[model samples]
Target: MILRDVSFAVAPGESLAIVGSSGSGKSTLLGLLAGLDVPTRGSVSLNGIDIFALDEDGRARLRGELAGFVFQSFQLLPALNALENVMLPLELAGAKDARQRAEHSLAQVGLSARSLHRPQHLSGGEQQRVALARAFVTRPRILFADEPTGNLDHATGAQVIELMLELNRAQGTTLILVTHDVALAGRCGRQLRLEAGSVVQ
Candidate 1:
């Protein structure tokens, strides 16, 4: 098992950092928390609902309603411009003003000028900013970030970190991030250290 006997609780509007070396099950734990993976045992609850008790479609619906995600790779569709990337989630959720909300979100990330540019045309930091805009556009109750700054240079990563924490505080979005950077983990309200698929702290 990639993860075993791991358990924890995150409060509403809290920021949590999960840290560990590679192969310590950080990503796997994230997937389970996000309801993107089903554990062979144990339960994960969100907003007082047990996610694993629901079917895949049910869990998906819950995610659509409450969750936003950022990834190390900046998981934007290459064909979609920054604005479009941000709009995708809002559109999926049947928002009537997806364009306006997306534009505002991109502006929040200081990417209005780059809104028309696709991922290929943007720098790594810009792409990640776009991803951030997309994640926050939904204004989700929970935000999951998996190595969100892993690909950026140190300076760029710091900028992204600042923006992320600022946004989290402003929106009261619960932040759950997996990272190897202790300094980054220290930014969270609490830190959960993992070792060999278990919580060591």
Candidate 2:
């Protein structure tokens, strides 16, 4: 099992960080919580709804409606420009104001000037900013970030972290992150330490 006897609760608008050494199941726990993966045992619930009780499509719909995600790889599509990439999720959700919201999100991440640039044309920091803009464009209630700063240098990563925290506070979004960076984990309202797939603290 990738995770065992791992349990925790996050209050609304709280920031919780999961920290673990390599191979300790930090990302696995994040995936399960996000409903991207189902646990072999136990269940995950969001807002009192047991997500695993729903069908796969139902879980996906729930994620689109209430959750956002950021990854270590910055997962932007190579074919889409910054603005278009940010607009994709909103468009998928059938929002009529996708373009406007995408613009505002890009501006929030200090990427307004690079709105027309594709992922490959941007620097690592700029690309990650675009990813952040995309994640927050929908104003999701919960944001899950897995090693969001792992691909950046120290300075750029710090900037990204600051931006995430600012947005989380401003929007009252519940923030859950998986990280190996102790300093980054320390900034959260609470931290859960894991060892060998189980909660150690």
TM-score on alpha carbons, each prediction: 0.98, 0.98
lDDT of 2 by residue, 1-201 (tens): 889888789999999999989999999999999999988889888978899999999999999999999999999999999999999999998999999999999999998999999999999999998988998889999999999999999999999999999999999999999988777888899999999999996
Provide the global lDDT of candidate 2 against the true structure. Answer: 0.93
> Model 1 over residues 31-106: C-alpha lDDT tens digits?
9999999999999999999999999999999999999999999999998999999999999999999999999999
RMSD of 1: 0.8
TM-score of 1: 0.98
lDDT of prediction 1: 0.94
Q: Which regions of candidate 1 fall more than 4 Å away from where they truly are?
A: none
- Backbone clash total for model 1 is 0
> Model 2, residue 142: what's the lDDT?
96
Per-residue lDDT, model 2, residue 36, is 93
